[model samples]
Target: MHGPASSGWLLVALCAMTGTYCLTRMRGGGATEQRRAAGGEALMGFGMAAMAVPAAVFTPPSWAWSVYAALFTAAALPALWAARAGAHHLHHLVGAAAMVYMSVVMAGSPARAHGGGGSGVPLLTGALLLYFAGYVLLTGVRLVPVAAVAGRNGGGGSAGWGDRPELTRACRLSMGIAMVAMLLTL
Candidate 1:
């Protein structure tokens, strides 16, 4: 199996691919395309979380882990703010809050100073798992309506999954995954 560092890089690559796919789908501009694009963005967030997981889990050097935690935490803000536009659901809010909590714990973890698992690790991992589970569930459900609309006749209306609902959910899922991974690693 690939090492943690390599796995992190691979996840980064996955994020890039998904992000690109999102861009393409956005340009295409349709219900199916938009929903798929949103899914792609969510996939990117998952990739980000995947990249951070090993660093958090293995207890990398304080600075490296700190940077990883910081980046993930910072990314969540725009996501949370954007959710305000009504694109996201309650699950997104919960997931984002969990990530924020995880980030704070990770930022202050004593494990980094000692370079091994310590008192707070279990809480961190548990929190992350919960967050990830919620995220996945929310994303999976959010897609249902969009998929349903896509199957409808007459190309659907101008307002549909191709609009805010799908995009918001996609972003919610993506950010949620990253946050969950970060928490788990902590």
Candidate 2:
């Protein structure tokens, strides 16, 4: 979060709120896959919020980066397994892997940890940026009223808050935007 304090705080708020909503989704009586997805989203949202905290406010210890990398690595395993059931889970896998990648990059570069924009591999960052940028666009298009209506009707009717596909897509879209912002900082 190498931007202004206001922008960093905004990122923190957006991510924390998304994480909270995902937690509630986990408690709702959605399908198994939906609940599972929510659980992973919750983890990702909260982790992003923590990482996005401005360095001026709190710089994590050197070892903490390793811990973040490890945690996300663990998260990715289930996402990889879940992808066997649905393609959407692959997005979760990529997100988790991206978190791990960022954590490692930050850990090795103290300058980046302090928001000085250290030497992360530009090529890798560009690749991730491209992926998440496409994701944000795709998710945004899916949020149109026509697409929402189709998704709802296809689901058989109104669903509980947690099972609402539109909300889930919106959540993912927000995360995708946040990811793009974060990568730009890198």
Please name the candidate that would achieve the greatest lDDT relative to the true structure.
2
- Runs off by more than 4 Å, candidate 1: 1-3, 26-103, 110-115, 119-128, 141-181
Q: Against the true structure, candidate 1 has what lDDT?
A: 0.51
- What candidate 2 gets wrong by more than 4 Å, as runs, is 146-159
Error of 1 at 85 (Å): 5.2
Which residue pairs come into collision in candidate 1?
Answer: none
Which residue window of length 10 is worst by lDDT in model 2?
Answer: 146-155
lDDT of 1 by residue, 26-121 (tens): 544566634543554554455354435444445445565456555555555555665666544334444445544544554576454232434255
lDDT of 2 at 107: 87
- At residue 129, give the lDDT of candidate 2: 94
lDDT by residue (tens digit), candidate 2, 71-129? 99999999999889887899999999999999999889956545677547889989999
Instruction: Give the TM-score comparing model 1 with the true structure, all chains together.
Output: 0.46
